[model samples]
Target chain A: MYQALFFLFAASAVGFAINLLIQRHPIHSALSLIGVMGSLASLYLMLGAEFLAVVQVIVYAGAVMVLFVFVIMLLNADKEEPSDRSKMAKYLGLPLLFLLLAMITVVIYRQFPEDAMVQFGDFPGQTAAIGRLLFRDFLLPFEVISILILIAIIGAIVLAKKEP
Target chain B: MPPAVILFTLVKILLLLVVLLTAVAYAVLFERKVVARMQSRWGPTRVGPHGLLQPLADAVKLLTKEDITPSSAFRFIYTMAPLLSLVFALLAFAVIPFGPPLTLGGVDAFQVADPDIGLLFLFAVSSMGVYGITLAGWSSNSKYSLLGSLRSTAQMISYELAVGLSVIGVLLMTGSLSLRTIVDAQAGTYWGFLPRWHVFPQIVGFFCFYVGAIAETNRLPFDMPEAETELVAGYHTEYSSMKFAMFFMAEYANMVAVSCVATVLFFGGWHGPLFGPPSLQVVLPLFWFALKVFCFLFVYVWLRGTLPRFRYDQLMAFGWKFLMPVALGNVILTSFVIVAWPALSRFWS
Candidate 1:
């Protein structure tokens, strides 16, 4: 049952990703990205990282994507102008895709045995467990990443400011 | 999954929706009546007795009214926006526990589901509601709508940070995000009188959170999106008929949801004195919960009647320059107390 559910979400995630790339209008593309984020969040839920899943939805799909959509609206971006597909890309794109898929499959096959799989709902990574790991074990790394993000935010603010 | 469990969940969801929708409809009327008295005006006297059936009348009118779609508007998004708004607004209720659990269930009987991160789930759902307003304004292809959407997006985004941050102090006290657990933590009273609610110590947090909640719902004093003086009905300017009704429904539903959360967080949820028979025990907690939520709704209306709307710049400045800093300070204070509190008490002893 879990496997079936996982496959369904996985398929949808990839499908939405492709749709995101192919959508002409920026808003639709943003919506498709949100779909991809949502499906991936579901996949994370199935993988037993419930906190990660919710955070994924709240941060990426909810907040970040809203900003992207807001920008699209603000700019009033219209449909993309159609571009001619290059002859080299048209001939070789499919072959390259299949080649990449085959290489990824081979790498996966060699990395682990088929029986090594995620036990459904086994590792219920509840909030407390993740908190202990974050604050106690990996506190430094977490703080470092947070500081890095804060710096980036300050940088953006500084950059966005106009000259007096 | 068991079919029985699924069936029961569906039944629970249906029950919740019916009660919630009816409550939201009446909440609008409640606001109108309360605000009317405050403003010294007779509001909707003709529709039913004392505007009792006014919500029903409004529903029928909106449903029967013509839905006009602009020629240049993005038809798909314009139509879907209100649904998105209302759905996410309603989704938060799934995790809200109205009362204590019955013996029949492992979790609270009044709540639909109690995930570990129930509070965060509510924030997430509420945050997603911004999309509806954003899309509605953007897809309308009208200048007023675009402007309103811009202000809304900025206002909601800025206030949301304060809202999220303001609740950290409560979480620090309860040590759990689950609404049921948080309420349970506030089970007993302090000094045999005052309820051991988080609101007492976390007053600043509660204040910030309440303000942020008001902003999040786009209520008066913070309602830049559709302030009638500047923007013509804001994001819903191009929306008409039932679609228009849906947006209002979303706003009211959001108000109820925020009220419920405040009751759960600051007010001790469903934790009142029990009296009467065992059968009445089950109903009494629900009564207390509803009473608390109703008071919140009443206060919401009172504020609308009393306060003038903030200017757009003032709104942003209040949320960021003042509210955010205060919320952050509250968080820091709460955490410091939590860590050093026991030792400090020991030192005094």
Candidate 2:
């Protein structure tokens, strides 16, 4: 059941990511990203990261993607003009992406040579459990991240504000 | 857990969908009648007895009408918008506990899906509702639709902050994210007379929530996105027939869903005065829940009738400048009270 659910969500997530890349219109691309987020959220749920899954939907899919969609709409973003970047960028970008992916894969492989299977309900991600870990264990990082978000918000407001 | 359980759940889902759709239909009629009466006019009496059959007639008319799709519209997104709205509006009902969970024949059954993150789930789905209106407006390829949709997106997104913050007070008091648990927390009474509704202590939260919900559902005073006179029916200006009906039905469904959530969150959901036999006890709670929900729906209509709509700037200013701060303050005050309750109790004793 876990494998089936994983495959389902993973397939859709990949599909949506591809769709995001291929979509001509910015709105469609934004929607595809939202779909990817939603599928990722479901996968998170299946992995028993309930809080993370909800947060993924609320923060990423609900809030972040809405902002993306809003911007796309506000600008009335047209279809992508054919890539006008230099040949160096085109040649280097793909290989660089692949290199990055390979490095991540290698790192993950080295971290856990024998990949453990994800059994359902193996790790409970209850809100209370996550809250404890966040506040107690990852307290400094959490506070720093929150401060970073506050800074970003202030930056956005400042940037977007009228000249007056 | 078992085949019987699955069967029961399926049955329950079917039952709920039908009941909810019917309720949505009547809610429209109820709104129309109430609003008309407020304006000293009879509403839809020609359709059936006191317009009781008006929803049915309207449904038929909508179904029979031509579903117009403009040549300039984004066809795919245009088609998806109303469905998206309706689905999200209905989805929240799944987590809302209509009555107490019942245990019968060694089977536990109550709401559709009582996830631990039910409140978050509700918010997540509701937040996504913006997409429908946004898409509808953009896809319509009309200036009015574009303007309306933009206003809606901003309004809903802004007001949702207040809505989420206000709910924190109740959640802090209850210390649970589950709607069922929140209801259970507010089950009993203070002094054995007054029901322990969160509204008493979280009055500001309740006010914020009510106002936020009104705005969220895009009802009167906050219905800037669909301001008929200003935007030619707003984001749905280009839509016709069943597509238009879908948007209309979606609005009413959203109203009902928000009301249901409000009832569960603030009022003692399904927790009311009870008398008579065990059989009666089982049903009375559902009655009280429905009654509370009805009151909320009525208030929505009443507000629509009484209040004139706010300008776009006024609406945004109200949501951001006023509602947001008040909601934030309410949360802070509630949290402080909760934190200091022990010391305060010691002094009182």
Candidate 3:
């Protein structure tokens, strides 16, 4: 069951990523990105990272992608206008990307044998464990990231504000 | 898990779906009737007795109506939007325990799925509902739909912060993310009379939560996205027939989900007086849970009838400038009180 679920989610994630690249409209691409994020979230759940799965959906798919869609709509973005002289780049890019991905897959496959299997119930991702790690072990980085987010918010407001 | 357990869960899921669909259909009727009475007029009396079968009639009408798609619209996203909305709206209920666990054939059964991160799961699904409205509007290829959908997306995201912060108070008091644990924390009463509900102590949080919920559901006073007078049905301007009904059902479903969450978080969910035989004891808690949910739904309709919609700027200002700060303050105060509760209770005792 675990293996089947993992393969299904992984395949969907890759399909969505490819769809994101091929889609002509920005909104379609954005939608595909959301699909990729969702399938990845399912894969995370299969790996028993339940907290991370929820956070992945809540932050990336829910918040960031909503912002992306909002901007696309607000700006009234239309279907992509095909660029000129892209055949050489396209052909070269695909093969290079495929080779790189295959190399990475082979290296990881060799490093981690088939015995390193993911059993869903073996590692329950309880919130307490995540909380302990976040607050105690990574306290400084957590605080610093929060401060950085605050700075970003302030900067956005300033940038968007109209001159008096 | 055994086959019996699996079958039991399937049965439970079917039952919950039917119950929720029935509730959503009736909620529409309830809103129309209450809002009509508030305006000193009759509503839906032409259907069944006092509009008892109005939802059914409305369903048939919507199903029979032509499903029109605009020529200029993006076909795929427009088609998928309502389904996305309805699915996420209903998915939140999986974690909401309607009543205590029932022992049937030596197996525990109640909620569909009670994960450890139930509260976060609810939040995550609810937040993802933004896509439905936004995509529907954008794909309609209409300016009004675009404006309405954008407003809704912005409104939902802005209020979500307050919603999350307001719930922090309850989470702090309970120190757990599970809805079941939160409900159980408020099990007993105080002074032998008052229920030990979180509302007494977290009154400010409750206010913020309800207000945020109202905004989140895009109801009156915060429903700028679909303000009929201004946006002409908002993001769903181009949707028709069954497609339109999907959006309608999604709205009511979200209302019910938020009401259930409020009941679970503040008013002890299925934790009321339990007495009588074992069968009665099991069912009584469900009654209490339903009563609380009914009150929240009624309040939602009452607010719609009584209040006028807010201006777009006023709504944004309220959510950010006012509600967020207040919710943050409520969280801080709640944390302090929770830390000092023992000492304060000793003095009072």
Show model 1 residue runs off by greater than 4 Å: B103-108
Q: Candidate 3 lDDT, tens digit per residue, B196-222? A: 999888999999999999999999878
Question: On residues A1-164, what C-alpha lDDT tens digit does candidate 3 reach at each position?
Answer: 67788889999999999999999989889989999999999988877788889999999999999999999988888889878857888779879989999999999899999788656765656688989988999999999999999999999999999999
Task: Put down candidate 1 lDDT per residue, B30-101, tens digits, no spaces.
Answer: 999888889889887888888799999999999999989999999999999999999999999999999888
Tens-place lDDT digits, model 2, residues B97-129: 988888654444558888998999999999988
Q: CAPRI band of model 3?
A: high
Candidate 1 chain A lowest-lDDT run of ten: A117-126
Best-first order by TM-score: 1, 2, 3
Using Cα atoms, each model's DockQ against the true complex is 0.79, 0.81, 0.88
Model 1 interface DockQ: 0.79
Model 1: how many Å of interface RMSD? Answer: 0.8
Alpha-carbon lDDT of model 2: 0.91
Pairs in steric clash, model 3: none
Q: Give all TM-scores, in the order shown.
A: 0.97, 0.96, 0.95
Calculate the i-RMS of every candidate, to one decimal place. Answer: 0.8, 0.8, 0.5
Name every residue pair that clashes in candidate 1.
none
What's the ranking of the predictions by lDDT, best on top? 3, 1, 2
Cα error, residue B46 of model 3, in Å, equals 2.4
Error of 3 at B339 (Å): 2.9
